[model samples]
Target: MTKVIAIVNQKGGVAKTTTAINVGAGLAKHNKRVLLIDLDGQGNLSRGLGCKTKARNQFTIRDALLNIQKGILTNPTKGILTARYEKISVMPANKQLDAFEHSLKGDLDAPFYLRRYVNTLRQYFDVILIDCSPSLGLMTLNALVAADSVMIPVDPEFFGVEGVEQIVAAMTDVQRKMNPSLSLEGIVIVRRNDISIAKRTNAKNLRLRYGSKVFQTELPTSVKASEASARGMSLLEYMSWNHLARAYASLVEEVLANGRN
Candidate 1:
């Protein structure tokens, strides 16, 4: 079965895109056919994977969504950019997506469009990862409705905990009203700085609050991540020996283990 995971946090700078990119890369490294869907208008996830978001010839996630909304007949694989060597593919996005939410306003079936779109892709991929925008808006709702599970990335900060609370509340709403099968994959501590007492405290609080729902692996702060993004490479590919890369590898294992359970 193809498993779709939405890496989401309603707050920015929490490494949601980072988690999506690396986790997708990690899964691909494990021989899984992965498709990354960039739902964020910022298009950072698309760019991070070396996709040309501005390419006029490329079919973006926005286009796909529009097709779904308008009931347009189009090839499902039309816009997917595949990295054959990495076993990964991308449905890119750009600033063109910024107005998508407003366009879907008051559309009763908006939430189901993404689910419908993703269904067409289920047979082609072993995994699909959606990189949500930094808000619990219509797009994220679509993602929540479409995904089998969600993974939240948090920096070790007070507001990070608050972000989790907000998204979890949204998840609860989604479960009750939208997708009853939606489950939380886990909470990940990103940009962790163990030397910082406050960060450690926040990490402890998160683990205590979420218990085993928190992943055992925590991604450490690293400039290499930014560099890798700049170079359009996964951390595992950019610097496999880096500690953060190793942590992400462990995270992939945990994700697979959770799926088996």
Candidate 2:
């Protein structure tokens, strides 16, 4: 069974897309067939994988939603694009996704549109990673509905923790009403600065509060991540031996191991 994981944070700049790209790439490096679904209107995941939207008429998740709205189970195989790495594919997003909320407004089955679409492709990949927009709106709700687990990236700052809390509350509501199987896979601490005493203390306090739900791997603040994104490559490809790359590799291992049980 494919494990659908959403890399979500309602607050932007928390390394959400960075984690999705690298983690999906890391899993692919480990021979896991991974599909990265870009649900965010920003299209960062698609661009990070070296794809330019203007080059072609790429079928996106928006098309899938439209198909579902019409009660047609479209096999979104055309939407799946090959990534720069082996065993990794991507479902790119476009600016038109921003109009999805208004388009599906008042539709009773709106929340499950993504869930139904993802189900059609579940057998084709070992894992599906959703890069969601930074909001608790319709798009985020669809991602949540489609996912079995969620991995939240926190920036090792005060507001990041608050964002995690908000997402947790939203997840609780989602579980109660929409997808009961949805579970928080773990909290990933992104852009941590151990040299800063305040940041270190906050990271510790978060781990203490969240306990086992917090992932052991912490992504340090590194120029490598940004450089990788700018170069349209994963950190593993850009800086193979970097600490952040290794941390994401470890995260993939942890995710795979947890999914087995």
Candidate 3:
């Protein structure tokens, strides 16, 4: 049984896509067959994994959803395209995904669309990581409905804290009305500079409020992360010796441990 995890944050620039790309890579590095689903319309995860949107066929998640709605029993794994990385497959998203909001309108089961799609691929991979957009809209709701657990990446800033609150509230709603099995896998504090007293204090408060849900590993903001994405690589592939890569590696272990139980 594959664990479906959504890497989400209502706030952008919090390393959400960065975490999804590298963490999925890290899991694959550990021999776990991972499928990365780029649910964000920006297609950042698709590009980060070296997949070009222009080269994709009409068989995207959009088409998969339409087929499923027509009772076609479309297999989710069929929509996945291989990435440059070994053991990692991707369901690449295109900018047209933004139209999903309009496409799903007047459909009562809209929230469960992704859940039904992922159910078809549950046995094909060890994990399915959803790279969600930074908003609590239709797309995010679909990802939440599909996810067994969620990982939120937060920057060490005041607005990040507020974003955490909004995410928690949304999770609560999902648990109550949509996905009763939904759990918050962890809260990752990214781009932390321990030398800054304010950052350290903010991290401390975050831990105090969230308790063990806070991840033990903190990912520092590194130029290597951006450079790796620009070069169509993960941090582990771009700067294999960097501390950030090592941190993500450790984070994957923690995620797997939590997920297995």
Candidate 4:
């Protein structure tokens, strides 16, 4: 069975897309067949994987969902793009997705569209990771409904706890009213600078509150990571010797262990 995990956070700039890219790449390194779904209209995840979202006649996540909604048939692999990386595929998205969300208004079954679409592709992949937008809107809700689990990324900021609270509340609501089997995979602390007192305190507070739900490995902020993303490559592929890349490797180990449990 395919394990679908949504990389989500209600707040932006917390490395949500970055985490999604590296984590999916890391899992692929372990020989896991991974499919990345870009649910954000920004299309950052697609670009980060070196996908040409603006290329002529390129089908996007927007097209896939709308096609699913309208019951239109084209090709089985209509919207999926093979990334340059190993063992990974992507369903790209673009700015047109923002308008696509609004068109689903008044549609009673809007929230289940992604779930329905994903059901058709479950047989081919070992894992599916959905990188969501920074809001808990209709698109993110669709991700939640389709996913078996969610992994939240948080920066060590003052408001990090508050942001986690909101997403957890949304997860709770989804559990009650939608996908009852959905679970929280874990909370990953990203972009940490241990030298800063405020960041240290904030991270300590998060661990104290969330306890074992927080991953033991925290990702350090690095210019190399940003540069790698700018060049459309994951840190592990761009600079495997970097400390941030090693940290992601450790996190992937934890993710695998958690899956076994």
Task: Give the CA lDDT, 0 to 100, for residue 145 in model 1.
Answer: 98
TM-score of each: 0.96, 0.94, 0.94, 0.96
* Over 4 Å off, model 1: 158-160
lDDT for model 3 comes to 0.85
Best by lDDT: 1
Write candidate 1's Cα lDDT for 1-261 as tens digits.
899999988888889988998999999998999999999999998889888889766689989999988999798887999643355799999988879878888999999988999999999999999999989999999999999999999888645466689899999999999899999999998877656788888888899899999999988988899999988878988899999999999999999999899
Q: Per-residue lDDT of 1-261 in model 2, one digit per residue for the tens?
A: 789999888888888999999889888887888899999888988888876654466678788788788987555676788876445798888887888767888998999988988988888898999999889899899989999999998877655456678999999999999999999999998777656776777788778879988898888877888888878789988888998888888988888778877
Instruction: Tell me the tens digit of each residue's lDDT in model 4 across 1-261.
Output: 689999998788888898888999999999998899999989999999888899888899999998889999767567798876545799999999999999899999999999988888888788899999989999999999999999998887644677788999999999999999999999999877656777778788889989999999999988897888778778888998899999999999999998999
Candidate 2 regions with alpha-carbon error over 4 angstroms: none
What C-alpha root-mean-square deviation, in Å, does candidate 1 show against the real structure? 1.4
Worst 10-residue lDDT window for candidate 3 reads: 53-62
Question: Of 1 and 3, which scores higher on TM-score?
Answer: 1
Candidate 3, residue 137: CA error in Å?
Answer: 0.3
